[model samples]
Target: MRVRKIQLKTFKRFDDLTIDLGDEPRKIIVMVGPNGCGKSSVFDAFEEKQKDFRPWGGEDASFYSKAFFYTDETKKASTYNRNNSILIEFYPPNAQSSRKTFYIRTAYRFTSKLNVQTLSAMASIFETRDEPLSSIALDGRLDANYKRLLSASYSAFEAGDKTGNQVRAELIGSINVILEKILDIKISSLGNIMDRKGEFYFEKGNATNFPYSNLSAGEKEVVDIILDIIIKKNDYDNTVFCIDEPELHLNTSVQKKLLIEIEKLIPENCQLWVATHSIGFMKAAQDELKEKVQVLDFSEKDYFTGSHTITPIRTTRKNWQRIFKTALEDLTGLLSPRKIIYCEGRDQPRRDGTERGFDANVLNGIFSEKYPDVLFVSSGGNTELDQRSEIAISILSKVFDGLDILVLKDRDMASGKNTTAHDRDVYLKNNPSNHRVFVRWEIENYLFDKEVLKKYCNLNALTFDEASYDGFVVDIENQNIKDETGRIKNYCGIVSSINAEKFKQELAKVITPEMTVFAELESCIF
Candidate 1:
């Protein structure tokens, strides 16, 4: 049922490779590697040689026949004896009829839009064709599975023992439980077969009676894998369940959840072997399963040159970083931020010609060249930032190890701080290190400093109209415009009525260390 050892020669993508699982293998084995790295070839070898390996049911002895596929035409001169295997004294050498040992689902798993006219008896699991490892063909099983479900209900109806809902509960209730938890939708009804409307319908929110085809590709994949496992558990109870790239079409978070749910459905006696390059799935295996899992890094050994053996790698930070490098390549840098500052603003841009993330964009524009690896994220208004920053930091810490996550708040009028920028600590007095507050009223207030705007005019060869700029600032302060953003917009309109966005951008561009506002802002941020 579980793999102890595997050997392959002249197999697809492998000339000679051996995978040893030691005396007692872990229940969950994750094969991690990049594309074209022989991960799928291991699955192919298992499929071709499955008949020679018998299920281990706590028997003192087990048997395995060596499997090989010669690539060169001349090498095929020697006939391969299918029944030949190295003999050990664990059990009787007399061979028994081959039994099912590997239950595999390839990466090309997909279901078409399905509708059934009549309920038919479902075929046994043994009767189903094992798809070749390379074929990209769709797996048309959802409709057939639906028929089997209806037939089970019809059989229970004829027996007159349980209601229709009860039969469904026995067949697909568990699958619905997982689906509801993941997608917030469940099977509303198995359509009426006699009415010539046999289809699987789903309900999400108040919407009801949607066909199977309406589901997203990721949703269908989730249902397909979980439903297949649930339906075949009785027949494939003690077999090695192999799913290749279970993360296909699913996002990172959903991939993690699906892997966990799939592990729950796999019988305790059976082992789960997953061949994947998904960070989410690998992370779930490492974090959630803990010591119960083993990760075989296929990227470590060069299988093409000659003979080689692979074993599970240690789950350390360095090894995980290498795995991420292999999996994501150049994209790995995007996720690895040395420092992150959460500031107050909305990051999303609206249809109107207004610039968003005024706080975050200004900080990034000013500090990006100085600290290239630091990231500034817009975390909404001050109140929302106060509520969500802690939870967000806790999560980011787990995702990116050793990341410096901090929060920066605006010094609004409510703070009752001195408006003059003489002696204000960037870090809050209550909590010094992680939580910081700006010295000015807000980011926009810093943008509107009279000295900063005068430098902007001087740099651009325009007239230094300090008198008009000061008049606008003085008028806004006299009006007591509490909203800093609206007050800045009014000042921009007075200066450049035609294009306030360009004016703000140009003024931010002119801000440098020469200006007092720039020095004050730099001192707080750095």
Candidate 2:
């Protein structure tokens, strides 16, 4: 079962938002927006809805009535209705069971504070059957739950109830997997409570143990999240998980890995929803979940009707790409490279036999060993490289003080009959310091040098004359390779069975230090 849709009217920042979550068994719904735009409010709305579905038994009120109770009063005057409400519908895999819908109007804070009341409440909730744990987990009140779990495990251990031991073992195993993958730390065992608090013991490569308290704040945060999930794993299946600001206290890499690990821990037939402000986390989520993830943007606005509305921008892949790209651009402080080089290529082979990274590899192969400070970014193709160069230079210039930026495009554009070497030279000269055109027809053409090809073919470079070079080009052209980029790749395969990347590496090693390309690059950099 998974959340099929959510409708909110006058609920906090959401004035009248209706989101349709497709009928997928499992999905990752990512709520993203600026501060106060209602990303967290999404989680708030979910918690409110969950409250109405009391497993312990509660008055069954109309869904609309429950939702209307939670409406934002500030908009009551402008909106036609004063009652605020939210509607949530779920899709169950089993058609025999009746459809479940929830209406909610109450909101509760998911805090992280560890207190006796919180512990007792979580303990009671955990022991209850079919009780949703998302409310507890989302509230940042997992510390109490963690303590209660440890206490229960201890009680079970003393009572010789192997069930408790089994649960602890599973939790420990899961935690270890997450820690090793995210933080590179492994827990040998979870230590018993000492001084009213339990701690995790880390196992060293040499078998020594250390206290979990010794872990950094970031490490503890990761551990806390993993522990929370493990403790509540039994309660998570077929439920909606709403996590607000999950990136808190974690670095970009950790934030990404944590979300991935959490997704893996979630049971099949369940949905994971996250509201976040971190672009790093969003990008990571997109990378990890791909098409399974939906990203919604929240922006606050005042309608001409004098009603305040928190609008949710349509969720689309292109929208997310633009959002992430813009976010990364704004976070220039995180950029590490002092110098930026934009080139036209990607590492993957294109239909044209040229890998999208061919140009990047060529540049990196030659310049990286000597100049490790420069960062080369591939722009996908020659035209894209040219287009992105100005944008990249303009953006990077503002971010990095006195940043050195260079854009390189293949000479392919000027290779046809109408364009001359002078035209290319003039273009290069006009852009002088930051722009350059390949001296050869293309980067691949340079790789087709007789010496490089001979090395792969196990033939002497001296054996390859101008006629051999012409014949090789003719052979490539005659093959009628579909992708222009793939032509060199196809030619290389025919001449030598060596892998393209390896061939490039070998060719790079053989390049003379005094090569014209090297001289040109040096002039541009220096």
Candidate 3:
């Protein structure tokens, strides 16, 4: 039900770019590039093209016939330029976008007069051209049909503690206070609390409110987006929101928050395409250890330990965001638990020696609809204890909300973290639950609270065998592995060789706010 692809031709630096929306899992698409490297140009190509597809603008131009790009030289405009031609192919995985994703072409001349006939030609693609603007529905419009003419036709505004121009760009001018949530920041304002009339105004030193006009140039960029979107609100209808260079004027943190939110705001049925040069924006979409961009992260050796990097888009041919679609999940309805099960790769050999496809049967029993998937739990997918443990903990926290759960943490036997039979017996006795190696704990009771762990200190922390942990390092002798050493040792390639059941045993030890440790997993037998 969502758009799955964006194809480009003759659009700026992307002489050609075809991006896949990843299979099964719907992921956030990130287009990365350096400034003036045509990242924004590619975005404009799509946005401008879509404009022509609309019946308005009275088309003197073919949506595909327009272009707006820098001249061949960095500082000079192209002296002998042609209307930049562009095409955007938007197709959804399901039957939803079948030939439905908007395609547009347009022509731009800052000095040219309006061409009604061209506009009419572009408009004809969506129903009859004779229809008036008020009467014509934008539901079927394509893009290039309008690309070049409306340079900044749309805008996004940002909210929260995010300041400066860049963060503000994410805010598509909304009068709604939801901005507070987007910025994750509190701004100073002098507004009155007018509850009855649904109004709030600026008052110095209030909750982080500022006048739109007074903000700096970068901050105004966000306001500009707000105004643009507000003026062209109708564009969202069956829209494909292609946002390029989202970090244009924002700080790293705000850039990330805004980018993260943009994916959520688009209508689930609507398509979203984004490109960025900032690593902050891509962090959520990229592999955690900088592991994905292995070669590029050569400068710092310590980045393996959750260190941050300012991602550089040095190569024009490389596509950074396009590669990480696997991590994308339409995080829009995160509050609702759409059942997902992350088990061991069904075919890959598991360290637990469990047979292939064993996870499927266990998962089927745990989530059967007759059982109504009441637990709405998931597998902590992987063969390694730590990665599996982390996956189990993360996905459950991110996706589940007040649901019963079953997490099958492998009883890792190869590592010291492995739960011995004695440890397993103790865990079983303490939690009093059983499902072979898999079991449940109520959300209220076992959501892995850091504060709780600090207080009670009863849960089994992830302790490695002193020898194995030491040998792993001593064996390497702090040699050339440098930056990659720590990460290589931590990834699933290494972890999967360890325990499968140890994780389950350890997770069973945490205490929930009210329920006993394993009550939820044990009660599922009914």
lDDT of 3: 0.36
lDDT of 2 by residue, 1-526 (tens): 5676667765554446677656653477776655656565556556555544544432233322323354566433433222246666677645221112221111233333333322233335434433233322223444455565667666777776577658678656767877788887887655554454355668756754576666666776777667766766675444666666767677888888888888888776667777776766775654556656766665333321223433334333335545564456565444345577787766355787543565666666566534544667777666677677778777868877867877776656643443445777788777656787655555555555555555555533333344544664663311322234344444444554556566565666555456654565465444
Q: In model 1, what are the clashing residue pairs, if there are any?
A: 1-56
lDDT of 1 by residue, 87-128 (tens): 111111232224456777888778857778865555665764
Say which prediction, candidate 1 or candidate 2, comes out ahead on TM-score: 1
Give the alpha carbon lDDT tens digit for every residue of 1-526 in model 3: 3444445443444434444444431334444433344344444444444444452442232222212253434533323122234433344433433222432211110111112222222332244342212211132121222221222222222233455443333332332343453443232321221322111122233434443334444343333333223323345446555544445567766666665555445555564545555656665444231221211222222221222332333221112323222123233232233333334434453698443454343333323322322222233343443355455556666655644333344333223353554664565566423223433221212322223223233333332333433444342211222233233324212354434333322333333324433344434333
In what order do the candidates fall by TM-score, top score first? 1, 2, 3
TM-scores of all predicted structures: 0.58, 0.51, 0.36
Position 46, candidate 1: lDDT: 59
Q: Rank the candidates by lDDT, best first.
A: 1, 2, 3
lDDT of 1: 0.68
Q: Which ten residues in a row have the lowest lDDT in candidate 1?
A: 57-66
